[model samples]
Target: MRELRILRPIAKLEDAAVLDPVVREVHRVVDAVLKPRALEDLLHGVPAGHPMHPALVLVPAGSWIGAAVLDVVPGASRASRTLIGVGVLAAAPAIAAGWADWARSRRQQQRVGVVHAAANESAWVLYTASWLARRAGHDGFGKVLALAGFGLVGFGGYLGGHLGYRQAVGANHADAVVQRFPTGWHELGVLDDLPEEAPVRIEVAGEPLFVLRRGSRVDVLADVSTHLGEPLSDGRIDDPGHRGATITSSLGSVFEVATGEVVHGPATAPAVRFETRINGELIEVRLPRS
Candidate 1:
């Protein structure tokens, strides 16, 4: 419910005339600088499909939790503190990965993400202060700092949940197999009207399809990219290789397409393949529907 409420304030702020300039500047910063590279890498997955952020979170969380437990134990040693330090250090890369992912989102999403990042950053600062205080023999101050850091981490985690479940950032919409075409083939349209070396938008049974004409054959795919709902037809075709073609979106995200294989990140699945007849010849291609 809080997540749902957060969107209300974001929407209301959008309507205020005074906020336009500030919002525009923020948009420019994100779009012009942060997006082109950081976002692309985040979505592309530096560690395969596994995002770096979630992987990194284990470090800090595990470290702090271990430290807290050590504090309560009867025979806790300096080694425990050292372990905590190691965990905190390990968490840094994950945080960087998550931030890179967040930087590329829409302004509204970025606004929420910024707060989320701030909360986590503050937690890290507090944790670091706690570590220093403990090492300096200020046990009380160290415990207090650790508690404060824990509280901040909790708040940050809450915001993260909202971003993921409510805003749907870094989520794959196509993961759910909502509907599937029948095993048998379905007709799209007359092949003659489709242009050569151009992506043509078409509909089959009310499903949007991106049809690419290559010589007499065609390559069809769902018009919408699985990642961020970007339009596939808007993407350009790249060189033919093991990566058959690269579809570049307006957002600067590139999707690789193989001859018979599903393209790389963003889109998790292969485009639906369709076999149809053109000029009395059987042609195989991929197209989108529903």
Candidate 2:
């Protein structure tokens, strides 16, 4: 089946050269400003186990939408203005969370994301203006501005939905590995060839894997980052011991080497881990039983 007509141009935005300059600058700025590991993890929702932007967005979205409803009702001017003010205030953190998530996404997703952010920022500006106008007793003008802002919000929301559902921007990339991989033990390679305390890339069972050996124990995980599919083998291995070892992806996601638990974000999903054993000189791996 063919894709929707509107999606053709939107999809083309992935390769749009016009956005490269802006995307680069925004990326630099965001990375510089959100340099603190703790802050970035919080924004990416590491503690929450998923992206936080979507949930944070509901506050401002609901407030602005509720304001729109109140605007049309008689004797509701004060309530509508209050709601608009509330939306303006609530939009700050939501925008921050969205930016944090966007900063770490792939170029294609970032292309759409930049436009999404622009639209939302424009809407926010309008809402802020509307609130100020209402405070200044310009009720009719405030209503007009609020309506325009709401329109931009709808457009921005559509782009956000496209980024998530269609483009798989914030989805867990490694969630399906176990489902498709064959069950039971599969031979990986000779145990002696597997370097000690170092990550190695191996292709087996139709998937790329990150293999790390420490003495008798071996830790295996899908080689793809759960955030954006950056090669986990290219990432830095920290505390390369059997216990408390972690791998930090190039894009700044940290995962526990043994259990595949996400230690940081922009990655909320754990890597696909494998159970390992040694058959003499040979190494074997299988998906761990749930």
Candidate 3:
């Protein structure tokens, strides 16, 4: 299908270098404030196993959209004001989660995200003002502001859709690894040739795999990160001697080397792991039977 003409300009926003300074500053600030590893992981949706921002966004967007509908209804002023206030308040945490996710995204995604965030923030501000205006008995003015804010919400939502779908932000880049390989066991390399407790990158059927040899057991995972396709083999390993060594992506997502489970976010999906068995000196790996 031909691309929509309207999207041409929006897509060009990815190359706008003007947004970089602001993006850098926001990244620094977010990194500083979300200093606690645990809290950062939570905001990144590590525990939820997917990005929380998308779900959290529904609350404020739904509330404000509902208020917009109620504004035209006679005798619904009180209820509309209540919904506006709820939307304004709920926007805070959603914004926090969004910024956290954006901070770790690729440059192209960040450029588009900056504008997306600006639009949403503007909407939030307008909604906040609308709530205050309504409380002060300026119902007509408040209704006008709410309507305007909802327009920005729609625009921002469109940009967010572009980011999440078009740009492939927050997608599981390694999700197709297992599918790319044939079902039977494939030889990776000799077990003794793999350096101990170090990440090794191997290619089988043209797909990169992250292999780690610790003591007698070997752990294998898709080399591409589930978050943004960063190379897992290039990342550092934590607790390499432990039962399950942890691998932190170049972009800060963490995963357990043993189980392929995400240990921290920016990565929501688990890495693709392979079941391994030694065929004498040759190491063979295959997708675990589910």
Model 1 agreement with the true structure over 174-253: per-residue lDDT tens digits: 43322644343556666676676677787765567666776666766666655566676777777733226667655444
| Model 3, CA-based lDDT | 0.91
- Candidate 1 vs candidate 3, lDDT winner: 3
TM-score attained by model 1: 0.77
Worst 10 residues of 1 by lDDT: 258-267
Among all windows of 10 consecutive residues in model 3, the one with the lowest summed lDDT is 170-179
Q: Runs in model 1 with CA error above 4 Å?
A: 1-47, 77-80, 176-183, 239-243, 259-290
Preferred candidate (TM-score higher): 2 or 3: 3
> Model 2: residues >4 Å from true position, as ranges?
1-7
Q: Compute the lDDT of residue 114 as modeled in candidate 3.
A: 93
Which digits, one per residue and each the tens of the lDDT, describe model 3 over residues 160-253?
9999999888778887786677888889999889999888899987888999998779999989999999999889999887876899999988
Residue pairs that clash (backbone atoms under 3 angstroms), model 3: none
Clash count for candidate 3 is: 0
Model 2, TM vs. native: 0.93
Give residue 61's error in model 3 in angstroms: 0.5
